[model samples]
Target: MLMAKTAIITGSSCIGRESAIALSKAGWNVVLTARRADALKETSLLCESLENCLVLPGDVTDEEFVKRLFNETVVKFGRVDLLFNNAGVNAPAIPLEELSLEAFQNVISVNLVGPFLCAREAVKIFKNQTPVGGRIINNGSLSAHTPRPMSTPYTASKHAITGLSKCLNLDGRAFDITCTQIDIGNAATSLTARMEKGVLQPDGRRMPESTFDVTHVGSAVVHIASLPPDVVVPQFTIMTAKAPFAGRG
Candidate 1:
């Protein structure tokens, strides 16, 4: 049987792109969206599930564009089965003292506002669709639990996502559109290259962070998507075993 009748993956950077590829491999008609058109094209070509993949390039930060993507997905695919709100960034990790208002707001816009808008639109679409339900998986961060030394904007936004996810899970019960959060730790990606060298530890010292392959995260996403609608995991954490997260302070 086909899994995820239809799927959407935002970001499509490291883990997002791989998640799209994996879900496409699982026989889901996938729609790949991001601000980069060329990258989306390249991603669409990298799938192996023999499913029709659409590359819709635009900013998730745009409310109109976000709604249009949702509307068009339902028009093209008949319904939306899963939405991976994975578009995010960690703007130059500097001390909070050095963070300008623009920098802080930009991170919040992309991480928090974008996800909020996307989730809202998805909820509308899922409710209106005949099945009256789907699934929304928010890409949260380990920072939602413990903050790093100088990642104020990223940390704050991720922590806020925890609350958003909780609300969605509770409110989505009636519609059968389950909502879940995946708090991921460091994975091997261009964004986390600094981990190979060293990163800030809880004690204010920089230490090298061991990273697991990005495929492990892809595997986790696949597992989350494979679950039956009746069995929803409200929150899940996927991280590197050797990573310094426990009591990370």
Candidate 2:
């Protein structure tokens, strides 16, 4: 019998949770991590094979915690085949001058620094393991391409993630490791619940933007994860067709 493929997914809510459930249902062993232990456990329980799902809750920004996350995954699953660099945070939407330095730093630490730490550890494992390669799928945002009004911190971090993904792909060529980014638009999740009311648009307007089901994100992730090793998708964008994105301003 073939050993099941393993994946470590950061963030245990919304996109993270849905991705875990989808991957679990697709026969991949999943390791879920996030700061909220309870949320992680809740996500794990929803997996198709509970026995194949592991929850390791902690802050992704902490170096030691990131190290432990990878260590524990190896101990449990023998090897990791994929890393979903999905944990992230967004600062309060405010003008650049009005944004607190603390809030900006917090968003950067979680959204950018956290992914860097995780990817570093994953590359180490991928390079040293018998298989000699793995894949990293980063959860980027549409903001990486177009900035929304008063979204400096979040936009900046996502833009940096695009650079990170490119670098990882270029550097991992020798090892057969691949990196891809998925830029998601408005997905109906708690984080975006306010969108049902209205959100600040670039034209100094507060508009109610359309959102797609979050489950689509889960399915997209599973599709990318299931791709053949020889194929690589550098960037994939998924968004609500009706969303005000094409002419967003």
Candidate 3:
């Protein structure tokens, strides 16, 4: 029943791409952003039947570029109803001592700071729209709760995301903007290929992780988007049931 709604999915990686397609199918005009123009275009094709889809290729790290992305979304679709702050990166699995400061900063830049910047832009646009409130769905990871072995960069970034989401939920209240964080694990996608072979577990072990259909993530995102604006699911985690991410991690 969503009508005349628009959304932006920053860093439309595998999960982001799936989320974008789901939202588009649910009748939201979707703007896709990522580093590569070609990849954005490819993701659009997958959502082909959704005529309102547009691709805006750019790096989320650039503040001006992120601002322009929000501006263009409003220009093209009139107003933004949601922002999927899903752009993120993971460093090669390595021990904490082995992780370089540069690597840590890089992960924070994309996985954490980028969302903050995009959310700021979204707040401006939402404040100006006729229905002056919108939803922001952040793409968090399982690592935020319990990290895998030697994943300091990725884990730290996602944990920061948890804090950011909490801040947004409280601060966005006045603006009628609601923020929700989706913590996902081992969703079958190009980004998780290494996990299929075997992954480092917490108990000083290596085991092949279980996988789940990416479409499950796609449908889950849509379910959240379909909810009434007055309702907010603060945080939800979805992952392969058999995936060693629960207490077994």
Local error of candidate 1 at 15, Å? 0.7
Model 1, backbone clash pairs (residues 3+ apart or across chains), number: 0
Give the alpha carbon lDDT tens digit for every residue of 13-76 in model 2.
9999999999999999999999999999999999998889999989999999999999999999
Predictions in order: lDDT: 0.86, 0.92, 0.85
List the candidates ranked by lDDT, beginning with the highest. 2, 1, 3
Kindly provide the TM-score of model 1 when superposed on the true structure, using C-alpha atoms.
Answer: 0.95
User: TM-score per candidate, in order?
Assistant: 0.95, 0.98, 0.95
Q: Count the backbone clashes (under 3 Å) in each candidate.
A: 0, 1, 0
| Candidate achieving the largest lDDT | 2
- Give candidates' CA RMSD values in order: 1.7, 1.0, 1.6
Per-residue C-alpha lDDT of model 1 across residues 125-145, encoded as one tens digit per residue: 878887688889999989898
Candidate 3 — number of clashing residue pairs?
A: 0
> What is residue 214's positional error in candidate 1, in angstroms?
1.2
